[model samples]
Target: MSTLNPYCPDCGAAVAHPHAEGCGVARCLFTGGRRLSCGSRHRADLELDHACGGDEWTGRWPGEAEAAEFGWWTCWDGPGPEQGWDYQGQGWVQVPEGTPGAVPDLDRLSTDAQWDRHALRWVRRVNR
Candidate 1:
């Protein structure tokens, strides 16, 4: 099995070892306690203790446009009924959640296919 290394999911930085006396928070490594640092800094304690599952991707992709452009769809309908489009352009487009993974050959698929593939891959990566 692969060992899980704790790192700052936000900045992808390695976490420093926690001090000898653990912080009251179960997973915090900083003995000084959790405090907001530079906007770029992410506290391991806060992230571990307070963040929920959904928080993992909180700021990673914050809006619908970002989701759509990057090929992310929260639901199968591709954001909404109006926005939905199918691969063949024949029926109401419905991009299912957990759709096919992103296609590296994006130039080969239609716009709808590209978005569907990318969104599925994004969701899978974040969920993992």
Candidate 2:
């Protein structure tokens, strides 16, 4: 087995430590792409409270439009059937709990594919 490097190759920051500003390898939580700053790089507000204010992307997620445009249904915060921006409907939709596409319990997801499918199907938030 290969050992993992504990330091960031671009900024020399230790693993689990925040990367230096503008570090190339820093991963963006919103898109899983490149992090633009030490702060959360979101399209909605541009910056989150901090890097670790709940890793799940909020309903104000930057990727929502792009995901809908590309037909990527997955949501970072697990919208379930209760709330989400429906691409087909072209409006934010909400449903009662226990709806057909309601997010399954986390423990029920036993595989990576299952987890991915769950994320892809759900959305976030409930107005009620």
Candidate 3:
């Protein structure tokens, strides 16, 4: 079973040790929420990246126990098939930057919940 604890299952960083840069398991030290550190993408040009990326001494990822309390999940897009899935091109539109409620580009299986999240149409896989 995957979990966060004295050591992160993904990055293998101890509770006291700083999580590696861009570690997906890291949490947001700036916000008092259950959101992950990478809830938003990091870009060098964005002024907010410095503060959001933990440049101001925000400590390591939260431990398993604390994470469990908030029902926080390290990975939002669940597991996929062994062969994995690919992003589909249909039902997508190119929108201007900073558009509210913009659809995120997804690399997902047809059955992924993200497909339903945006009401995007998908077909069931057929066994060969």
TM-score of each: 0.17, 0.30, 0.30
| Model 3 pairs in collision | none
Candidate models: Cα lDDT each? 0.30, 0.39, 0.37
Best by lDDT: 2
Per-residue alpha-carbon lDDT of candidate 2 for residues 53-120, written as tens digits (9 for 90 to 100): 11222222323333333232322334345445452442323333344443223221222212122243
Tell me how far the alpha carbon of residue 51 in candidate 1 is from the true structure, in angstroms, after superposition: 18
| RMSD each, Å | 16.2, 15.1, 15.4
Q: Which of 1 and 3 is ahead in TM-score?
A: 3
Tens-digit per-residue lDDT, 1-128, candidate 1 = 11234544444433343222222222211221122321114444333443211112222222223345545443222333565544333332345335553213222123333222223222212322
**Alpha carbon deviation, residue 59, candidate 2 (Å):** 30
Tens-digit lDDT track for model 3 on 1-128? 13324665666676556656666665445432223534434544333543443421123333323323323233223233522456333344434434543332222231222112122122223551
Q: Give the winner by TM-score: 1 or 2.
A: 2
